[model samples]
Structures are given as C-alpha cells and as structure tokens.
Target: MWGSDTDVLNLALAATVAATVAAAGWLAVALARARRAHRRSVDERGWLLERERESAARTAVDEERARIARELHDIVSHKVSLMVVQANAAREVLDAMPQEAEKAMAAVESAGRDTMTELRHLLGLLAPAQDGSEPAPEEAAQLTPQPSLSRLSSLIDRFAFAGLPVEVRISGEPRPLPTGIDTTAYRIVQEALNNALKYGGGRPTEVTVRYADHSLRVEVLNSGPSVLRGDAPAPPQPDGERPDGAGRGLLGLRERVAVYGGDLDARRRLGGGYRVRARIPLERA
Candidate 1:
C-alpha cells in the first residue's frame, strides 16, 4: 500500500509538470503572434505616411507649375498684343508716312526686346543647376525685377503707344504694399487694359487705384463700344480664343486675386462699356 501511494504521488507530480509546460508553450506562441501583428501594424502606418508625403509633394509641384503658366501668359499676352498692334500700324503707313512707320517699327522693336528680356528672366528662375549649385553671376544679372505698381506709369505708356488712350486716377494716400500684392495689382491693371485695347473699339479707358483704410482697390473702365466693331480687323487672338468678351485672362486674374482672399468683379456696365474691379484686403495679404 505504501508503494502504491508513492507511485500515485509521483504520477500526480508528473501530470502537474506536463500541464505547466503546455501552458508555457501556449503563452510563447501567443506572444510571437502579437509581436508579428505589431510589426505589420507599424509597417502599414509607415507606408500610409510615405504615400501622404508623396501626394503633398505632387500637389505643391502642380501649384508651382500653374503659377508659372499664369505668369507666362500675363507677360507674353500683354507684350505681344502691343507688338502686334504696332506692327500692323507700321505696315499700314509704311509707304505714305515713312517717318511715322519708322517710329511704329521702333516701338515694335522695343516691345519685342522687353518681351524677350522678361521671358529670359522668367525662364532663368525656372531652371537651376543640375549640380545644385548657385546660378552663375552673368545668369543672375540677366534676371529683371518683376512688374509692380511702381511701374504702372510705364505700363500705361506702352498701352498708349498701342493706340489705347488710358487715363489714370489715384485716390487716398499711396503707401508701400507687400510685393505680391503690388505685382497682383499691376497685373490686374495690365490685363484689364489689354482687354480694353483688343475689344474696346479704341475707346478711351480709365484706370483707378484707391487705397482704402484696409484694402487696395483697382478699377478699369472702358468707356464705350466694348466689343470690336464688325468692320474693324479682328486682333490676333491669344490662346486661339476670339477676344469677343471672355477668355482665360480674366479667369486667371480671378484666380490671382483669390489667392490673397480678394474679390474681383468683371462685367459690362449697365449703361455701356466694360468694368473690371478688384479689391484685395491688405490685412489678409
């Protein structure tokens, strides 16, 4: 009986050991599975983050390209319009008024040169050395300053040379504006005057710049005969669209103004003519 009792106690001890070992093995397998799940979760999160970064980078690049396109359109459209008008005028009076034709040709030359210079500067800004080095001194020197309100007078003169008489009025105290706002303001005037020149039937136009307490307002009013007369030779169209009232120029202008949380109104006046008005809040800018 003593031996049998001893044998039973030994059997119980071995059973307890086996149960403990089985529980430990189960725990080890569960821990390994949890570790693998954690690693997979971490890797998935990392992949999502990387994709987000790439998406943001692509968005930034797209925005920058759009901005460059807008700038190119503004510069080329304004300058080339002036050049075409001058060239046509030159061709018309080439025989009868040789001296006048010479003057018009000179204006054409000047406009062309200005356009080339601006294009070079703009293109230069787009390109950087593949080696990631700074631009050469000569290349840097070729860059020209961007157009701004300070150059409004010259801009108007160019339009005047193209046969669109423009009158400018300034209200309120003139103050220095942020660079972007200044350029935007200048572009607003330019595009408005460009439209007026093309489609205003050579009417007298007015440009008004008002500096309010909190905002800058720009207005361009084409006095009468907003659309080109049927008899008049149609001007060369920009972007293959007839200047018969609407195109990407005004749309681009709206986009530009919207960037600074501004408002732009472009419409035909109730009585006559066309009016383009833009108001940019200085505080938001």
Candidate 2:
C-alpha cells in the first residue's frame, strides 16, 4: 500500500511539471506577437511621415510656379504696352507729315509684327503645360523682349476698356519715356485700375496719366460708399499693400513699380473712396 501511494504522488508531480512547461510556451508566443505588432506600428508611422513630406513638396512646387508666372507677366506685359504706344505715336507722325508718315508707318508695322511674335512666345510660357514635362529655361530666354517707351496709350486704353475710365493728360512735348519708366507707369496704372474695379464694388473709377519733364505719373481713384461701413467681407489681397479687399492687386502693383525704382502711394479718400498714385522717372528709353 505504501509503494502504491508513492507511485501515485510521483505521477501527480510529473503532470504538474508538464502543465507548467505548457504555460511558459504560451507566454513566449504572446511576447513574440507583441514584438511583431510594435514593429508594424513603427513602419506605419514612417510611412505617414513620408506621405506628409511629399505633400509639402507638391505644395511648394505649385507656389513656385505661380510666382514665376507673375514675374513673366510683369516683364512681358509692360514691354508690349510700350511697343503699342510707340506704334500709335508713329501713326500720328505719319499723319502730320505724309512723306515722313509713310516711313514711320513702315517702321510701326515692322515693330508691331515683331511685338506680336514675341507676345505669342511669352503666352506659350505663361500657359500651363498640357503634358507632364516641365518647361525649359530656353523657352523663357527666347520669349523675353526689351520693350521701350512707345506703348503707353494702348496700355491705358486696354484698362479703360476693361472698365476703368482712363484718360491721358500730357503737359510737355511727348518725348520718349524710358523703357523701365514706361513699364512702371503702365503697370502701376493697370494694377490700380484693376484694384478699383475688384474692390470698388461696381463704383466708378478714374485713371489719369500725366507725362511731365522728368517723370511720368499715374493716378487711379474710385469713389463709393465707405468700404468700412459696408457689410462686405474684407477684400482679397493679391499682395498686402492695403487693408482693402484689393490687397493682392495693390501688392502686385507695388512690387512692379518698385522694380523700376518707382514710388506708389495708396490710401482711402477722406470723403469715402480709394486712391492710388504712382510716379516713375523718365531716364532710360
């Protein structure tokens, strides 16, 4: 009977040892699973960070593209306006002196044709790509032109037609204004008129162009009920030169005029309106 009891205890001890081993094996498997899960979580975090970086890069590329387009517009439009103005001046000369007018007309035709060609080239650069390929720098080099003093009137007329009432008042004999000066003047007036129309809330606006001995002046004024009193949302700014909704437009104009070493002033009229004034030196035709 004592031997039997001893045998039974031995069997029980063996069973207990086996059970303990099985539980330890299960604990090892659980630890392995937790480690795998931790690794997967780390990988997922890395993937998310990579995606965020790519998104930011894409946004930066888009912003850079817009900035380049604006610069090209300023350079091209300013030059083209000058050419058109000169062509008109030539036509005036041709009318006054028939023999000289014939020669002047020929020159004007040649200039107009050349300007049109250049404009087409620049337009191609301004337009977004149809294909995924990026534009080459050579395209920009080929498209740029050196425009001078002759294209102011046509530029002003374009604004007038666009909705701003623009008028030119020449005080001195209309000699050639410098290229930079002419471009600055045209852009300043153009931007100001654009601002007036956009932020003026359908109010009447006036643009006055003045040619003086040493300087060219452009002024744009729009009158309406005070913007401050209205329930209208703040005007959108293209740039932040003014508090009005026309900020961007005014800012762009300000930068443009500054390039030619020009001065611009913008303010709200006391009675209730907006005023923009730009002055450029006539030194480099």
Strongest candidate by lDDT: 1
* TM-score for each model: 0.80, 0.45
Question: Against the true structure, candidate 2 has what lDDT?
Answer: 0.63
Model 1: per-residue Cα lDDT over 1-285, one tens digit each: 999999999999999999999999999999999999999999999999999999999999998898889899998988898889999999999999999999999999998999999998888768777788988888787777888999999999989888999999999889999898898999999999998888777889999999998899999998764234424434647466344345687787788889999988887764557789999998632
Give me the overall lDDT of model 1: 0.86
Model 2 vs truth, CA RMSD: 12.9
Residue range 114-146, candidate 2, lDDT tens digits: 556666665665676788576688765665454
In candidate 2 the C-alpha lDDT for residue 177 amounts to 60
**Candidate 1 Cα deviation (angstroms), residue 281:** 1.8
Q: What local lDDT score does residue 261 receive in model 2, on the 0 to 100 scale?
A: 76
The stretch of ten residues in a row with the least summed lDDT in candidate 2 is: 236-245
Q: Quote the positional error of residue 233 for candidate 2 in Å.
A: 7.6
Runs with alpha carbons beyond 4 Å of true place in candidate 2? 1-68, 72-119, 123-164, 227-234, 237-246
